[model samples]
Target: MELDKMDENEWRYHGEGNKSLVVSHVQLSIVLRLLKYPAEDSENPPQTVEQAFRQVQNIVDFSSNVMSCLLGEKFVHSGEVVKLPLEFVRQLSIKVQHQRPAWRCDKVMDIYSGCALCLPNLTSPTLHQPTHTPTLCIEIKPKCGFLPYSKHVSQDIKTKVCRFCMHQHYKVAMGTWKRRSRYCPLDLFSGNRQRMHFAIRQLIDEPQNNLKIFKGGRCIFSSMDGIEDSMDLNSLLHHLRPYFQYGNNRINSHMTSKALLTDFIQVVVNALLSAGGGDGGVGTDRRGEGRSFCEASLFNKERSRHGSQGSPSDSVLYRVRQTQMLDTLDIEGLYPLYRRVEQHLQDFPKERTRLQMDGPYNEAFLEKLHKCPSEDDGSLEYAVSKVHQYRVAMTAKDSQIMVALVPSCEEEEDDEGLPGQRQHRDFLSSRPPAFSYSVSILDLDPKPFDNIPRQLRLDQNIVSCYLRSSCALP
Candidate 1:
């Protein structure tokens, strides 16, 4: 029985999103992601069993095949899907109830789900690190990095303000969020060193849902909303001292915790900057002199268009910006195209099969997706192809970045036998601590195609509220 079924007690709640619940295994370096549905409609849920199965399959395939192509394979993890015993899943859900956020309790676990995705515990230190070494993991959800360039966007504000910033007003008005977050996606995605550091600090100040910090696979700091006993900045800094301290420079009572906190933020900034390119060094540090989003947007545009030699095209920000360009039409224009494609599918039954989720996850289908319309040919196929690419690009825009840092052991660094082990240093402070780190993008789940209209409505609402309130930044 033990071999056939998982032990519920071995797993604890990790975190949850709108669609899923994750549980980390206590004894193993792996996690199980199970699907969830609204509890109110459990008796008659909107999604059928077949649809749910297809949804799960689409996530695995899209992450492994589609997103992995767009956002490099080294950064994305395509976990295997496995069947879990029904009783085990039910027991597991019950065990994790108390840990879930109060606001997220509207949705309950899908106990009927036989399958769950098994992914490597990203918060855990990798094999190269010693067992006792502490791992500090920071997860950042940098939403919608670029300002809309679509001519069809009727609102001029959309061109000036980013989606994340505008949505903050809407979120606040709706009482979903108590206040607007100061962290701007444009800053982090600016590819500017100082700006990125500023963005990280803003997230630390008011994390909301944008940032989460974990120590040794246990969450140390995140938003305090409905989450019990979460650590504040001071407590977080105290806990982080050991990682920032160097040889013989122990983080004793004499050492200022403020310095260690600043150094730690620099380490994260360096990891994010460097992870996009070749081994060791951070990417190009384009300085915006701490300009406003509108001002920085212009600078960023200039930098992206006429980037110097060795622009680090492989950098993660570059990849994201390129993908964001797919939505040049923006939702205002894309919605009409989506509707036309939907109408066309209704007219032609055979064409509907092409958009169905029943197809096997493979390269052939990906090739078909890749072969998009080169231009606006004003055909049904062109519209269909455009909408498809837009949805795929949305996944990239909403993805989360994980920066995992582990304190380097002297013996491990001295092992000259190992090739390609480029150690990164904290360049922000004098006598910086040396640490090994890795950056990865997670939550590459494919967005539903049907959300196009909903997004259009939300975009309109956000702009209207932000404008009506006269909250446009100078």
Candidate 2:
């Protein structure tokens, strides 16, 4: 299965085979080259080749354990769906530092733990006592997993309050309030502060809305992770066996895992952006837009085969650098209160997230892709041309992290001199138990959808019978 972010120029695929020997050799070679004896324009290698090799080996072993934990519940299962929780865009580095990894592995650091990465140092016992920075690869697991069911919404007092708190909470904590009365956690009983607390008080007064908070939902099931819940369709029909099913019956076997995973990942990426107003505008109803899977991708067919090519040599196709994309935007440079990101998500009614994927996985697209020559071949040109039509490439230069008010049972004491004073207990804090945020993919788990039951629901007799009536095919 191929996954591509044309905008970021990144791609990934799935593989299920054991190649430890080959992988280890490749890792060793990389280490040797990095720490090789000879010096170029750069400084001398920190360690000898043999030392580097051992470190690399240690890294590989550590990575395996980390991967296993990230996979979590899916580790032992086959055809496992994988999603890297950390969203930082730096390349994996082999730390030439003298100290070993604090945990099971060698001295290599958890990429998130580095002070250079711009993560906040939460001073709590939960943090490592020495550094007070998080040691584990902290990732946010999506509470609801996918988008909750909401299509149209008005900007209620609750939403505005949530946004105001989310956008301003950090500033208040840092003693950098812009609009002083907007939301002062200290003046909890004051007039304007009381008005700002209206939404919070409303939830506290009403029991129903309070219930949804624990369930990881709010007044509206906002479109998140790219599912324009505006899908008015009763149910999604997952077709198993298309008429042109290719060799080895690729549909029955491979279809269940890779294909679903491809769409799932794309949906999530979009949802995350939309939740944070990365869509740049309001969400659109994709189905209402009269869009259909070109080759019946998820619908179980091939992409329309048109012999065409897009700009194969076009260097700047989706040219937004990682540093620029808000998804991976550096946090250290960001200011908590003055952070200028897309605000007022409730302004849009329908989900504004755009669809990135063209169609689900199909052999024809793959075969045509594989047949393409190194340069501009007819097959490649055709695939690229069609891919262009999936979704209009959109970029936002000023996107910021999405944070909203969350309901929590905890509260921070007003005492500033206390040990936990820096750690705010209010609902506005981004740190968890009481905040809803769509900042980065770090907050999401890459768990695969259960397709076994969906596949079993498919029967050849039912498919053929339905096809005969619908398409009049003999």
Q: Score candidate 1 by TM-score against the native.
A: 0.87
lDDT, candidate 1, at 26 = 88
Q: Which candidate is the best by lDDT?
A: 1
- Per-residue accuracy of model 1 over 1-474 as CA lDDT, tens digit each: 242667988889898888889999887778888888898876665576667677678789988988887777767787877778888987988899988888889998887756678887877636246546768899998888777766788988877777887787788989987877878788787666666767788898889889999888888888854555464887888778767666455634445776776788888876776653344343443332232254323234454343322214556666666665667688998998988887886798687667643344467556656777777788876786677678777988888888777766555554332343222222222255756676677787878767889988888898899787655555
Worst 10 residues of 1 by lDDT: 421-430
* Clash tally, candidates in order: 0, 15
How much lDDT does candidate 2 score? 0.21
- Stretches off by above 4 angstroms in model 1 are 1-3, 44-49, 247-253, 276-292, 295-311, 356-361, 414-431, 471-474
Model 1 residue 448 CA deviation (Å) reads 1.2
Indicate which candidate wins on TM-score: 1
- TM-score of each candidate structure, all chains considered together: 0.87, 0.18
> What is the C-alpha lDDT profile of model 2 across 190-233, one tens digit per residue?
11122213322222222121111111111111111122321111
